[model samples]
Target: MSTPDTTQHKLIVLDMAGTTVADDGLVELAFTAAAERLGEDPATMIDYVRATMGESKISVFRHLFGGDEARAQLANLAFEDAYGELVADGRIAPIPGAAEAIAELKEQGRTVVLTTGFARVTQDAILDALGWRELVELTLCPSDASGRGRPFPDMVLAAFLRTGAVDDVRRIVVAGDTSYDMLSGVRSGAGIVAGVLTGAHDEPALKEHGATHVLASVAELPALIREFPA
Candidate 1:
């Protein structure tokens, strides 16, 4: 939902991996499993996996499989198998202060949309665990959309549309941990683009890519929102 002001909306879109969840160990695990399927070293394959953080799972898998549809599909099966087991075993949880930040946004009457590169299978459970299912009004996962994911503004534009923030871009604040997230926010004409170091990039990298604000993590979001004018 939007603010009561009615003059413009107050929208916040959050990214998953580095922004909301700490997948450092799970990511490494998935890489190891997928690499085994490819007969490669998990350590050697990490760069590829981490580089695809802001992309759809299929996109990431496809890259790992050398863009071959058949191999990508096979590798994806293995990766998901490993990741699913990890989640089922209580090995994953929301990042520090993630749930609190989203709750604060909602309490302030802002529309908080979750945009991620995760497929529904992964995102649904994550949201469910974090008890954030009802707090969000929109969820845009790449598997459900068109165009490239991040660095293309596809999901950002889609979030704006479904959240009714398209007309009031000034009230839009897109936050993520990847350079792709920052660049996509800029391309989407968002009023604010904040980057978090807890994700895949650092403060300097985020600023170099045109972030309006760079914070340590999503934990700092409530303060930032409060300081921003209505």
Candidate 2:
């Protein structure tokens, strides 16, 4: 018998850091470094950062700075600088099997779009580090979306709008490792909201945030999609 075809889903929107790329504490490190420079309590700030994983850096900074735009802008710049330097220093790598997963999905003719909380520069850095400059068909960051990043449906919706391939949001599949990712998919009315554990939030948190399925990582995504009933 032939394998079932489950590429019925039109698009798969993915998160970059922590989901596709190995975070390796680089995000927390950048957050801590920025917090220390800005005179915030590193431990407390890091906890906040953990909770807000998958959200845009400017949004995170806005919350961190008590909604002060100027302060948030300053902090955002610092965080981006720190993260870029880390990426340039060869501190980032693709999560094991992530690249292969993307390749397989693309081979199946599924449009793979990467969405992330990081700005364009940080996003590009990770793409370059992983040598996945052309692996994904499209990439979206907070600024690319008209609205906000994860925890909001803007990035995912933006992907839909930009691609013009996914006619219905319900035919879209959203997968990531954070609660924000789950919430974004749910809010966007996606067909499947899957959570992977290679990153920030755990299973319980993902479920609580509206994830429909949970997997070990993006490496498992191609199999799951392939096994789904068409």
Candidate 3:
């Protein structure tokens, strides 16, 4: 068996929603609500949405609408509206210790970035809710990275390009809460790919998709980072 690669890391790419923030199934609620408004089968659409967690919202819409771009755009707009209302109603919260972990990482001079599948406005709402508008060095959405999100490595690689803090892909750690997040990290060639159980996918699903480590939540991230071999 090959020995585990233990490269020293300098950057951490994180996922929002179920990873760094409390999900509370709000995304599902928003999707189901949109589906109901669109007169689609809520059960089927929700199952599809759950299966494609971490994918771009537009892409998910496209899939749900059977590749009808116009209809997908309408559905996506509805989703954004519903999610925005939910956020405005104070239904979202930060995951316990997430802000602390981010602050700790920043204090160590490590580059920490937040990546999300949500659109820009929705992501900003989350940041505003958590009062983390300035905590992370950068915040990214699928549109910020050629409209491609997780499971494609676009967002992770975009972090490398946008931040310029990453001298080498192998010196990066990618942590999130979904299989798509793990797959993106793996495909991006990051040295350490971790998954947190706070999101949509479980440890087994994450591992199957290429998670090098799995944690109970983002609260455990700092310790995991500190334990990486120098």
Candidate 4:
């Protein structure tokens, strides 16, 4: 008997904020609010936040507060609260065709998982705001994967292990709108590390971080996945 072929099946891991969801600088806005709430200057930390766009929120706060765990926790909580409020204000929307693209991938027999660098609360709030609570079978936040996030590969690997969509890491497809997303994909050994122009980083930055393909938006993802040879 021959082994079943799983090569044609892919486990697709997608980033939320900038790739599937249109961010519109909401992250920075929320960061500013969080910083102000804590009486810290946003100007001092905004650069770091921008530079590490796809990193875990708590991880970002940890660095911003110079590894002071208490300050980091407070800032992370404030950031999540501010972001949740902004989300409740109807500031977020799906990137044009993002939903259709995911549907297409699913139709193609691929498993799609949405991953986020936000905390579980913020992630849930965004999903609820978008009515995407049932969009995919599984959505992962940093906390869901041992508290690790993008640029680390933990969440990507978690998706792989949890979904069992594909047996090989190379059968995984990772897509996002930031350089850190590209790095996470690369680190996870995914076959396709597609970067979109709809978010935080540009083409050069995406490519520099290890994007296998650069797309105009997540809208182009289904086609790209279709074209990849099994």
Best by TM-score: 4
Q: Among all windows of ten consecutive residues in candidate 1, which has the lowest summed lDDT?
A: 1-10
Residue lDDT tens for model 3, 1-230:
76443334768899999988886888988998888888887887777798999888889999888899999998998898899889888888888989898888777668899999999999998889778898888999999999898788998999999888768998889999988999999999998899999889998999999999999998888788777874
Cα-based TM-score, every candidate:
0.87, 0.95, 0.95, 0.96
Off by over 4 Å in 3: 1-8
Q: What is the C-alpha lDDT of each candidate?
A: 0.78, 0.88, 0.88, 0.92
The alpha-carbon lDDT assigned to residue 102 of candidate 2 equals 89
lDDT (10s digit) by residue, model 2, range 54-162:
9888998888778999988888888888988898898988899999998998898899999999989888888887788888879999888874787899988998998
Model 4 error, position 107 (Å): 0.9
Best candidate (score: lDDT): 4
Ranking of all candidate structures by their lDDT, best first: 4, 3, 2, 1
Off by over 4 Å in 1: 1-9
Residue-wise C-alpha lDDT for candidate 4, range 7-103, written one tens digit per residue: 4647999999999999679999999999999999999889999999999989999998989999999998999898999899999999999999999
RMSD of each: 3.5, 2.0, 3.0, 2.5
Quote the lDDT for 151 in model 4. 93
- Provide the global lDDT of candidate 4 against the true structure: 0.92
Report the lDDT of model 3 for residue 128.
90
Q: How many angstroms is residue 20 displaced in model 3 relative to the true structure, after the best TM-score fit?
A: 0.5
Which pairs clash in model 4? none
